[model samples]
Every structure is written in C-alpha cells, then in structure tokens.
Target: MRRIGLQLASVLVLLALWAFVAAMRWVDPLYLPGPGAVWDAFVRANSCYPITEGAARKICGESNYYLWEHLVVSLQRIGVGVGLGALAGVVVGYLMGSSRLLMLLVNPYLNFLRALPPLGYIGLLVVWVGIGESSKYWLLFLAAFPPVVIATIQGVASVREDQLLAASSLGAGLRERVMTVILPSSLPYVVQGIRLATGFAWTTVVAAELNNGIPGIGGLAFQSGVQLQTALTIACILVIGLVAVALDQVIVWIGRALVPWQGKEV
Candidate 1:
C-alpha cells in the first residue's frame, strides 16, 4: 500500500510539473503540449472524423490505420522477429560455447555484426529485401540477435565444472546432462537475454518503420512529428513506452515461472 501510494504520488508530482510548465509556456506549444492537448489528441485519434479530400468523403476513426492498428502491427513484427532471433541465438550460442573450433570460426563475424549499429544496416536491408515486412523483420532480428547470443554464450561459459562432474558421477549420459543440467543452469541468463532483446526490438521499431511507411506506433509517431502535431506525437511516444513496459513485465513473469529458483541464492 505504501509503495503504491509513493508511486502514485510520484506520478502526480510529474503531472503537476508538466501542467505548470505548459501553463507557463516555458516551451513553445508547437514543441511541447499540455496534458489537456494530449488528451484531446487521443480522443480525436479514437473518435470518428471526416476526411475532406475524398469525392464521397468518409468518417474514419482508429479503423483506418489508427492506434490499435499501429499497436497490432508493431507487436506482430516484434513478436515474430524477436522469437526467431532468440531461438537462433540460443542454438548458435550453445554451439559456440560447446566447441572451441566453432567459436573460433564464428567469433570474428559475430563481433563485426554486433559492433555495427542495428539501424546502420537498414539501407542495406532495404536494398536487398525491399521496404517490405521482410526488411522490418530483419531489422528487428538484428536488433535482438546479438544480445541474446552474447548472453547465452556467457551463461554457458559460467556453468561450474563441479556441476558437470556431479552429473557425470551419477552416470548421466550426455543428452541427460545437457537437458537437466546445462539448459536449466543457463535459463536465468537466457531470460535476461530475452528481456534485453525485447527492449532492443522495441527501440528498433521506429527505425524499421522509417521508409516502409508501415502502420505502427513508431510510424504514427513519425507522421505526427512530421505534421508538427506535438501533442499527438507525445501521446504516441507515451503509448510506445507503456506498451514496452507491459511487454517487459510479461517477459519477467514468464521468466519467473520458468526459472523459479533464480536469484534464490541457494
């Protein structure tokens, strides 16, 4: 109860500060809009509005590339990209960790790729794959893949030799040892990697949507900025942040369920 109260109070303080700054015109309204302006923009985004440019004209709300559509598109891209990347990273990381020759062969390429900024390859991806869903997926995959791979490798390398010895002394076969010991021991690191990858995936969404003009939160935000709709842009940014937090919490919940023993200090 106390913690919740404190959180609420903190939010209230921030809101108060924002209202003050906006009311005082500390920043130009074109660049910074008040909470009320943001709320109006949100309402407008959700409500039916007329388009004057069409022959017959039509009322459009969120149905025509609105908030929900943007959210869904972004979520789908992130989900598919992150899921595949994490899976592939785990496999490659395990192979590299288990075999010195494999590590030697793959290390240089992995280092080079990981060192590059994820968005730096957007132009290359657009050229190779076109400005389609495939490009966005590849961008997000690159954003997520490296962290997961590095984390998995670190996890595998951190496994204590005594644990392996114990498994061997118990007459465990290679498969059994790997399944029961190696995988479980590495799960905490895997979860951490996934959490990190999720954030990276979200961060990459804006860059992925740059030229593709895909219906996503990032694209909406970009459009809002281009139109100088500061309130709408801020609203879109807030939505993105809230969604990221919610997704991260889901990942945390899954991690807790899968590795209940994690952080127990046993």
Candidate 2:
C-alpha cells in the first residue's frame, strides 16, 4: 500500500509539473503540447461519434484505426516475433552452452547482432525482405533473439554440477536430467531474458513499421510526427509507454506463476 501510494503521488507530481510547464509556456505547444491537448488527441483516437441516428450508424475515429486496433496490430507482431525468437534463442543457447566449439562459432555473431541499432539494419531488411510484414517480423525477431540467447547461456552455465551428478547417479539419462532439472532451473533466467527481449522488441516497433504500418501504435506515432501533429504523436507515445509497462507486468506475473520456487530460501 505504501509503495502504491508513493508511486501514485510521484505520478501526480509529474503531471502537475507538466501542467504547470504547459500553462507557463515554458515550452512551445508546437513541440510539447499541453497534457489536455494530448489527452484530447488520445480520446479522439479511441472514440467515435455516431454519424447518423439510423440503425446503420457508422463509427469512425479521426484516424483510419481506433486505438485498440493499433495496439492489437503491434501486439500481434511482437507476440509472434518474441515467440519465434525465444524458441530459436533457447535452442542455440543450449547447444552453445553444452559445446565449446559451438560457443566459439556463434558468440561473435550474436554479439555483433546484439550491438546493432534497429535503424542500422532496417534498410538491409527492407532490401532483402521488402517493405512488408515479413520485414517487420524479421526485424522484431532479430531484436528479441540475442538477449534471450545470452540469458539462456548464463542460465545453463549456472546449473549446479552436483545436481547433474546426482541425477546421473540415479541412473537418469542425459535427456531426463536435462528435462527435469536443467530446464526448470534455467526457466527463471529465461523468463528474465524474455522480459528484456520484450522491451527490446517494443523499442524496435517504430523501426519495424517504418515502411508499411497502418494500424500500429508505433507507426501511428511516426506518421503523426511526420504530419506535425505533436499532440497525437505524444498521445501515441503515451499509449506505447502505458502498454509496455502493462505487458512487462504481465510477464512478471507469468514468471512468478511459472517459477514460484525462484528466489525462495531452499
């Protein structure tokens, strides 16, 4: 309760500061619109008034899509991208962790990929995969992959040798030992990686949707910025920030549910 109260108070303070800045003209509205304007922009994006009183009252927001549609499109892409990236990363990570030669072969490339900014490869992806959903998926996939790979590697390395030996002494085969012990022990670390990878994927969203994004939050932000609709852009950013925080919390909950044994004194 105290933590929640403190957090709410901090947000209120920030909002009050923002309102004061906007009121005092500390910054031009062109660059940093007032919170009210931004909120109105958000409401416009989310709401539609009835065009006709008849049965066929067509609903329409200011933009081509409502906020939910934009959110859904972006989330769908991230969902698929993260799922694929995590699967591949776990496999490659396991192989590399188990074999010195594989680690020597793959680590440099992984690091190189990890170090790159999304913009650096956006052009290459566009050329190779075209300006389509495939390109976006690939971009997001690349963004999600390396963090998870690194996490899994660390997790694998952290596995206790004694546990493995105990399982071995119990006549357990390598597969059984891995399935029962190693995977469980490493799961918490992998969840942490997924959390990290999710943040990366969210950050890459604007880049991924650069070429062809219609109903996507990041794309909306980019398009609105280009149009000089700063309020709408800021509204889109608020949506992104809020949704990212929510998604991160959801992942945290999932990790707790899946790995309840984690962090407990055993």
Candidate 3:
C-alpha cells in the first residue's frame, strides 16, 4: 500500500510539473503539448471514424485507422511473433541445454545475437524479405526468441546433480528424468523468459511496423511524428507504455499461477 501510494504521488507530481511547464509556455506546444491537449488528441484518435463518401480517411491519428484498430493490429502482430518465438526458443533451448555438442555448436551464435539489439537486424531482414509483413513478423520473432532460449538454458543448467542421480538410480531413462525432474525444475526460468520475451517483442513493434504498418499503434506514432502532431504522438506513446505494463503484469500473474514454487525462498 505504501509503495502504491508513493507511485501514485510520483505520477501526480509529474503531471503537475507537466501542467506547470505547459501553462508557463516553457516549451513549444508543437514539441511538448499540454496534458489536456494530449488527452484531447487521445480522445480524438479513439473516437475517430472514416466517412464512407470519397476517400474514406480517418479524422485523427493514422490516415486509415482509429486507435482501437491500431491497438488490435499491434496486439495481433506481437502475439503471433511472440508465440512462435517462445515455442521455437523452448525447443531449441532444451535440446541445446541437454546436449554438450549442440550447446557448443550454437552457443557462439547465441552469444553474438545476445550482444546485438533485436532491431539491429531489421535492415537485413527487410533487405532479404522485402518490406512486407513477413519481415515484421521475423523481426519481432527474433526480438522475442533469444531471451527465452537463454533462460531455458539457465534453468536446465541449474538442475541439481543429486536430482539427476536420484532419477538415474531409480532406473529412470533420459525422457522420464526430463519429464519428471528437469522440465519441472526449469519451468520457472522458462516462464521468466517468456515474460522477458514479451517485453522485447513489444518494444520492437515500432521498428517492425516502420514499413507499411498502417493498422498498428507504432505506425500511428510514426504517422503522427511525420505529420508534426506532437500531441497525438505523445498519446500513442502513452498508450504503448501503459499497454506494455499491463501485458507484463498479466505475464507475471500467469507465472505466479503456473509456477507456484517460483520465488518461494525455501
């Protein structure tokens, strides 16, 4: 409760400061619009609709979409990418973690990728795949892939020698040992990885949507920036930040439910 109170107080103080700056004209409205302006921009974007007469353009934000449309598309793109990435990461991570030869073969490349930002490879992906939806999906997939793999690897590695020995002494085969011991023991790490991957995929959405991304919030932000609609851009950014927090919280809650043993200091 105390922590929540502090957080709320901090947000209020920031808002007050922002209002003060806007009221005092400390910055140009074009650069830093007032909170009220930003709120109005958000409302316009959210309620915007296209007239079905001529060209059918939206009244605010993106030329083609209202805020909800942008949000839905963004969510879909992130969901597909993260889902594929998480699936592939778990499989590859488990295989590599279980085999010394495979780990040696792949660890160097994984290390290289870990050192690079997910967006850094977007240019190459675009160049190879062209500026299409595939490139965006691949970019976001790469963004979400590595963290989970590394986490799974760490989890597998953290398995105690005694657990393995006990399983072996009980005449358990490799498959049984993995299913009963390694997999369960490593679940917490895999969940953490998924959470981390979600964050990474979401952050990379703007970059992914940079090419032909009309129906996404990232694209909305880009369009607003291009049109010098600073208030709308700020509004889009706020939406992105809030949604990301909400997503992370969701994953955290799911992790708590799925891996109840996690974080218990026993």
Candidate 4:
C-alpha cells in the first residue's frame, strides 16, 4: 500500500507539472498538448463518426478515427509475431546452449544480426517480401527474436551440473533430464526473454504498420504526426504506453504463477 501510494504520488506530481507547463504556455501547444486537449482528442477519436446516405446509411457512420480497429490490429500483429519469435528463439537457444559446437557456429551470425538497428530490417523485409502482412510479421519477429535467443541460451547454460548429474544417476534419460531439470531450471530466464521480446514487438508496431500503410495505432500516430495533430498524437502515444504496460503486467503475472520459486534466496 505504501509503494502504491508513492507511485500514485509520483504520477500526480508529473501531472501537476505538466498542467502547470501547459497552463503557462511554457511550450507551444502544437508540440505538447494539455491533458484536457488529449482527452478531447481521445473522445473524438472514439466517438465521432460521419453520417452516410442511401443504402449504406445504416452502417455508414464513418469517422476519421477508428481507435479500436487500430488497437486490435496492432495487438494481433504483436501477439502472433512475438509468439512465433519466442518459440523459435527458445528452441534454437536450447540447442545452442546444449552444444558448444552449435553455439560456436551460430554465435557470429546471431551477433551480426543483433548489432543491426531493428528498423533497418524493415527495408530489407519490404524488398524480400513486399509491402504486406508478411513483411510486418517478419519485421516484428526479427525485432523480438534475438533477445529471447540470448536469454534462453544464458538460462540453459546456467543450470547446475550437479542437478544434471543427480538426474542422470536416478536413471533419467536425456529427454527426462531435459523435461524435468533443464526446462524447469531455464524457465525463469525464458520468461524474462519473453518479457523483453514483448516490449520489442510492441515498439516495432509503428515500423510494421508503416510497411503497407496499415491501420493500427502505429499508423494513427504516424498520421497524427504528419498532420500536426498534436493532441491526437499524444493521445495515441498514451494509449500505446498504457497497452504495453498492461500487457507486460500480464506477462509478469504469468511468470510469477509459473515460477513461484524464482527470486527466493537459496
């Protein structure tokens, strides 16, 4: 409760500072819209719609903004891309961790790819796959895959040799050792990697949406920036942050449920 109070207090302080700055016009409203303006923009984006005529009249309420649609698309892309990337990363990482030769073979390529700026992959993906959903998914996957791989490798490598030896003495085969000892021991690190990958996936949404001019929160932010809709842009940014934080919290909860022994001092 005390920690929660402190967190709320900090947020309140920031909001107060922001309100003061906006009220005093210390910065141009064009660059930083006040909270009220952002709220108005949010309401408009969600509620405002256009009336239509003729046969399309019943369902023809078209608004310049479709916040929900954009949010759904972004979530779908992130979910699928991150899911695939994390699975592949865990598999490859387990293999690399288990085999020094495999690690040696793949490490150089992994390092090379990881060193590149994530957005740099966007152009290459566009050229290879064209501007389509495939390109977006590829970009997101690339954005998320490396960290998970690294984390999984580290996790697996950190497993105690004594545990493995004990399992072996207990008549455990390779598969049993992996299933009971290796996987459970490495799960914490795998979950950490997934958490990091999820952040990457969410951050990559803008670049992914830019590929085909797809309608997502990223597209909305890009359009708002292009049109100089400062309040709307800020609203979109706030929405993105909120969603990312919410998703991350969900991941954290899952981690706690799966690895209840994590963080306990030995």
Candidate 5:
C-alpha cells in the first residue's frame, strides 16, 4: 500500500510539473502541447469516434488516418504472435537445456536469430508472407522469441543435476523427473522470461503496426505526429504506457498464482 501510494504521488508530481511547464509556455504547443490542451484533446478524441466516418470526412477520408477499425486487427495479430512465440520459445529452450546434442545444434541458430533486429527481416517477411497478419506476426514473434528462449534455457541449465539423478535413482521416469525436478527448479526463470517477453511484445506490436500501416494505436500515434496533433500524440503515448503497465501487472499476478511457493522464504 505504501509503495502504491508513492507511485501514485510520483505520477501526480510529474503531471503537476508538466502542467506548470505548459502553462509557463516553456515549450511550444506545436511540439509539446500543454497539459490542459492535451486533456481537452483527449476528451474530444475519446468523447466521440475519433476514427469515425465523420472524422475521416474531416481529416481526408483515404489517408492512413482513415482507419477506424484497424485497431482490432492489430490487437489480434499481436495476441496470436506473442502467444505462439512465447510458448514455442519455452518448449524449445527446455528441450535444448535437457539435451546437450540438441543445444549444440540449435543454440547457434537461435543466437543468430537473436542477433538480428526485427526490422532486418521486415522486408523478407513482407515479401514472403505479404502485408497481412502473418507479416505482423512474424515481426512480433521476433520481438518476443529471444527473451523466452534465453530465459528457459538459462533456467533449465541452472537446475541441480543431482536432483535429476536422485529422481532417476528413485525409479522416476523422464516425465516424472521433469515434473518433479526440472519444472519446479526453473519456474522462477520462466516467470522472469514471461515478464521480459511481454515488454518486447508491447514494443514489437506497436512497431509492427506502425510499419505495416496497420490500423492501431501505433498508427494513430504516427498519424497524429505527422499532422502535428501534439496533444493527441501525447495522449497516445500515455495510453500506451498505461496499457503496458497493466499488462505487466497481469503477468505478475499470473506468476504469483502459478508459483505461490515463491512467496515462502527458503
């Protein structure tokens, strides 16, 4: 509760400072809209359909800004890509961690993929997959894949070999050994991986949307920036931050629910 209060106070302080600066005219409204102006714009933008037919009629109907329905498309793409990428990464990472031969064969390739930026593959992904959800998925996958993979790999590798050997000596099969020994040992790492990958997911989701000209928050932000709607742009940024924080909290809650043993001191 104290931590929450401190965080709320910090946010309020920042907002108050921003209001002061904007009121003092320390920054140009064209570049940095005043806090009051941003609040007004947000009210205007959210009060009505900011991406409605009327909005299009007001702001050039055929532009990228013309998309009012693409936000849902972007959300779906991110959901699919991030979900699959994280799952695959955890599975493959565990397989590699368990088998030395598999690690040797797959680790180099995984490292190679990790080294490359998502943008480096955008053109190829677009050419191969076209401009649909597949391309966006590929981009988002690239964003989330590495963190999960590395986390799982490190988690499994760090487990005590003695525990596995003890389970084996006790007549435990490979499945039993994994469930009783490997999984419990590596759950903390898996949680950490999920946390890291979520941040990647958020970033990659927005970047992919903007690059593909998909109709989403990122596209909205890009359009507002292009049109010099600084207030709306700031509002979009704030929205993104809030959404990311919400997602992080959700992930943390899941981790706690799944691994309550973590709460007990050893």
Candidate 6:
C-alpha cells in the first residue's frame, strides 16, 4: 500500500508540473495541455457527451452516445484472447515439462517464436487475417502464450525428483503421481505466468487495435490525438492503465485463492 501511494504521489506531482509548464507557456499549451484541460475533457468524455466537434454534446441534449460500447468491445477482445492463450500455455507447458521427447522436439521452435518482436507481426497479421477482431485476438494470443508456457515448464521441472520417485515406488501410476505431486508443486510458477500474461494481453490489445483500425480504446486514443484533443488521448491512456491494473489484481486474487499458503505468508 505504501508503494502504491508513493507511486501515485509521484504521478500527481508530475502532472502538476506539466500543468504549470503549459499554463505559464514554458511549454505550448497545444502541445502539452494543462491538467485542467485534460480533466475537463475527461469529464465530458465520461458523461457520454465527448465534446464532439468542439461543442458540448451531452446525452440529455443529443439523445445518446456513450463510451460504454467502446469499453465493452475492448473488454471482449481481452477476455477471449487471454482465455485461449492461458489455456494453451498450461497444456503445452505440462506436456513439455513432463515429456522429455516432446521438450526436445518443441523447445527450439518455441524459443524462436518467443524471440520475435510481437509488434513486428502486426503488418503481416493484418495482411493475412485482415483488419478485424480475428487478427486482434491472434495478436493478443501470441503476446500471452509464451510466458505461461515457459513458467509451466520451469515449474514442472523444478519439482523434486524424490517425490515422484517415492510416489512411483508406492505403486502410484503416472496420472496419480502427476495429480498428487507435479501439478500441485508447479502451481506457483503457472500462476506467475498468468500474471505476466495479463500485462502482455494489454500491450497486444492496444497495438492490435491501433494498427488495425479497430474501434477500441487504442483507436479512441489515436483518433483523439489526431484530432488534437490531447486531454481525451491522455484519458484513454489512463483508462488502459486502469484496466491493466484491474486485470492484474484479479489474477493475483486467483493465485491467492488457489494457493492459500500465500495468504498465510502475507
């Protein structure tokens, strides 16, 4: 909590400095709008009005327009991509960790793919899949899958060999040994991967949206900045950060639930 408070205080101080610089014309207000301008834009944006065409367009006055739809669109992409990637990572990681033959055959290819920069594929993906939700999801899945797979592999390999040997000596079959020992021991690493994957998902979602002309938070940010609405652009950036943090917290909560020992340690 202290860390979070300190980080937020630092952000507030930077914002204050920025506002002062712009207000005093040390920085061009057009280039670095004051905090007041940003807040006014944010309020208008949240009110579902958005100050379109440099005039107020409140829901009451203009019937109905809202950020909710855009928010929902972005959330849907995040949900589907993260879900698919995490599932695949866990399964493949388990296989590679437990099966020596599989690991030898797969690790090189996996490493090569992981080494590639994620954003480098945006143009190719757009060309192959077209500018649509499908491409967006594919990009996000690529972003998330590698970390989970690596964590699972490490977790499984890190388990004590003696435990498995003992289980085998007691006439425990492969499935029983895995259930009682491997899965339980490797859970921490797997959870860690999920946490990392959440961050990856956010980056992929924004990049995909921006490059592909998708109508999501990234698109909104791009549109606002292009139209010279610096406040709205900054608000969109804030919204992205908030969403990433929320997703991260949810993952942490799940980790604590699954491994109650963590709570005890805390």
**Per-candidate TM-score against the hidden true structure:** 0.94, 0.94, 0.93, 0.92, 0.86, 0.87
lDDT of 4 by residue, 1-266 (tens): 99999999999999889988999999999998788898888877777433553443332111243687788888998988999999999999999999999999999999998788768778888899999888888888887889999999999998999999999999999999999889988999999999999998898898888755447899888878889999988988999999999999999999999999888632
lDDT of 4: 0.86
Off by over 4 Å in 1: 52-57
lDDT of 1 by residue, 49-90 (tens): 657755466665443766777888899999989999999999
Write model 5 residue lDDT over 109-226, tens digit each, in one string: 9899888877778888888998776788888888888889999999898778788888999999989988988898888888889888877778766567656554677767787788
lDDT of 2 by residue, 171-246 (tens): 9998998998789888889999999999999988988887888778888889999999999999988889999999
At residue 222, give the lDDT of candidate 4.
86
Candidate scoring better on lDDT of 5 and 6: 6
Q: In model 6, what are the clashing residue pairs, if there are any?
A: none
For model 6, residues 1-266, the per-residue Cα lDDT tens digits are 99999999999999888877887888776777778887787676657543565676535211132344556678888788877999999999999998999999999988987887778888898999898888888888888889999999999997888999999999999899989888888888999998998788787666878764445877777777888878778877888888888889998989988977632321
Residues 1-266, candidate 3, lDDT per residue (tens digit)? Answer: 99999999999999999999999998998899999999998888867655664657856545657797899899999999999999999999998999999999999998898778866888899899998888888988888889999999999998888989999999999899999889988999999999999998999899989888888999889988999999999999999999999999999999999889876632
By TM-score, rank the candidates, best first. 1, 2, 3, 4, 6, 5
Clash count of each predicted structure = 0, 0, 0, 0, 0, 0
Tell me the alpha-carbon RMSD of every candidate.
2.2, 2.5, 2.7, 2.9, 3.6, 3.5
Alpha carbon lDDT at 177, candidate 2: 89
Superposition TM-score, candidate 4 onto the true structure: 0.92
Stretches of candidate 4 off by over 4 Å are 50-65, 264-266
Candidate 4: deviation at residue 234, Å?
0.4
Q: Which stretches of candidate 5 lie over 4 Å from their true place?
A: 49-74, 263-266
Off by over 4 Å in 2: 49-59
What TM-score does candidate 5 reach?
Answer: 0.86
